[model samples]
Target: MSVATAHVDIVAPAVPGAAPGTVVGAAEVLDRSNRRLGRVPLRAEISTPVEIPHEEQCLVHGWSPYLSVQPIVVTGGRTQQALLSARPANGKGSGGEESRRAANGWIRLWGREPDGQWTVRDPSDMATGGATAVSTPMGSPAILQIGGGRRRPVCTLVPEGSLFTLQPTEHRPQGPVEVRPVADSGFTLLESLRLGEWGWATVVERVWWDEPGVRGTPLFDLAVAYLACRRGNLERAGQWRQVAGNRHEDGPAWIDVLAVDAWLARRRGEWRDLASALARLADAGGTPLVAEGLDLLTAELARPPLEPRAPHPGEALRSVLTPYLRASLPSSLTSFTAAHPGVPQPRPPKRARPSESLPFRVERDTSATRIQWRVLSGPPVDSGAYAPVADRTLLPREPGLIISELGELSEWLIVEDEDPMVLWRLSRTLLDEGVATGVSIVPGRNAVAVALPGLQVRPAAALLADLLGQGRVRRLGLSVGGLRQELSVPDAAEAERILAVLLREGHRSSP
Candidate 1:
């Protein structure tokens, strides 16, 4: 049989129930088996109104009740004195006024030496009695010991307001403790679910599932699987989901899990499985999540796979030229083409008949600085010449027949035979003079329309008024398909009135 030995040591209480300013002594006694034996009595001396002074060491006393049973003598060094002072006692109120008041006086002692301050010589150092040996400092007041206890009380003087108070008590060990309101399995599941939503599913599994001595909760594992799927971790999600399904048949309904599975299948390009999964979701009353999955799957299935086509030159040319024409033409033509959708076939130039001869009409404005040319023939024959025209110039004709010309010239010479000489001479004159004067000889209405679609009468009238003054256009004539309208105004005022009439009726100028 082994005899147990008990050992003691000091300790601080773990509980926070002590009153303010209360100081106590604590101890722990252990048996040979290392088990707790019992608490021991410890005496402590607490200074009243415990003061924490700057740059000064304070003295406190601690004792154990077991010390009495197993007597132990503790010894230390010399006594040092610190100066203390007390003020006169105030007589605020007293029924027994005859009682003599203690002297309103003070006490003072020298503070400990700068190097080695006050020290305790013996336990009786704090006894409430006269010192055996002493020589009072000349200017210092006498020191006093007000009380006695198992622990000695040293004599130290203090100011009236600086009296330190002491209250001592014994401490006991607390009983076995436990936390309240243990969490349920569902609560754990919810916590895991929340963490998984925050992209911490793997962390949850490592910390809560695979940890040593950890207990796994079914709902929590399933929740982790669901979050993994949502994060696009399909393989991990499927593994966990399989575990959950195998472990518990009455788990979260398949409908809740099928939507994510379908999405995963689609991502992995498992079209057959994706279709099956989506069908399952739809049969599950097609919840919003399920419906979204089905919609995505449907779109994916409906899309036709890419069938590469060999490149063709004509297609490439059309793609390039189409944008160029649209940009170069006027906004009116561009807008019209956009509004009317088709293959965007170009408008064919008017065709000339083999038997007909179309002549050109040339006229000069009153200033004689501008020239205008028009083709005079019904449609078919009215098709204008495609050859280049010339402007005014000097030419040595046929050795002696010399001709010099100035001012604007019409390059619209109608020839019975296809004569390159006439066309060449005309083109040279037009290029020199017409270009210099910024004049353009337009052949047909189609060319003019293409160049300046905004030249329709209403806009043209506005432009004329802006260029000249208001009502400057006195006469206007336009013909299309042999249907013509001619309007003449006596003055600017009458011209504005007629222009207003035409504008309101949507009868734009026809070329």
Candidate 2:
């Protein structure tokens, strides 16, 4: 199904040039939309509804222009009809360019089957010839029914309950995102259709992302943690997991826990970290079963490793062991252990011998904070036991507080910071003092003097006062992600003053 025909028009077309993927309401059109519009590098505001063909809409790059995705947020934008979807670059809209129809395809709903396959849900209670047959009027922002079409006066299809809803994973660049919502303003767009306005749209009572907001759910954190694990940044994954540990109700979504368990096992003797993780899993949702398996397989860090032994009936194994069916557990640990290898024998931390060429080197990249390992020296002789071979670039899911590795490095490297203060504060906190510290300040967009000043650095916030007070640096602001696999901000002239104050306050002395 073409996106236009499939996804409901999600926005009421009043505000223009608003942020992509944001849901705004009519009441907030002036406040939120206006503030976002001000941030826009361009001035593309056109509040009056303008007609543009679907094919002319620009394709949004990031989680944008979800024009066809429904349960719309009332946002304002030049292409107010579309959200993440944008105007096709080739179009001047009113010019003499030939117009082509946007392609359409089979509309599918978001659902999964029991056997790990995806399937579609029938839009029951929906008239067979409802939305697909009619063109979507971008001007509206409600779930319009054929009978509920044309919000001239809202048809009564809503109070009856929706036939189906889109259930997407949250907080993903490719998935769903929602901004904060306001109190339910008694205001609503009450236009309803009599016969043919089903797709025209009316004001929904509790619109998409407006009532009790998305922040209340753990789905966003789960999705973020999942993505961090996928990227092989265990530090970030662990941090997010900690943030979400209290959300036991959403434990089923930790889809990568097994892989996490495997990697955690490889850490020299991270039995504590591994145990904490498993405990959370048990208490949160998949306890008893998952905990038992992990303890037996990944928990041991003994030398020479304990020989594989058969279980001697479970009833008295431990006080925590509850009676569970054998079928619930894995039949074989041999393959699993061979694939991931149980706990590695303990060794001194990597920083102990900085001069030695190591088997693996973990570092982060500027874009999208990814923690990856590039093989340095070949893998040690027992490399076969480790699931991740030394030759391959490995994105480890959990490296267990690997910051000390960076602290011990004695090399000259440039870690560029879009926000210099974050680079300053974090590196100072995480790295060993005087790890060849130097500060780079770009006080103004047009400022010529880029300085590598020799001063005791401090918390990023203080830099703003020093540099900006001297009328040298631009304004400053701040934010965080884990260092190993995350991202942060600051600027220069004002940056200097901020540094002085921070240093005097003893927050940090070097970066």
- Number of backbone-clashing residue pairs for each candidate, in the order shown: 20, 53
Once fitted onto the true fold, the runs of candidate 1 whose alpha carbons sit more than 4 angstroms away are: 1-202, 207-218, 248-252, 286-511
> lDDT of all the models against the reference?
0.27, 0.25
All predictions: root-mean-square deviation over Cα? 54.0, 25.5
Candidate 1 lDDT for residue 395:
15
Number of colliding residue pairs in model 1: 20
Give the Cα-based TM-score of candidate 2 against the true structure: 0.23
Question: lDDT of model 2 at residue 404?
Answer: 34
Candidate number of the best TM-score = 2
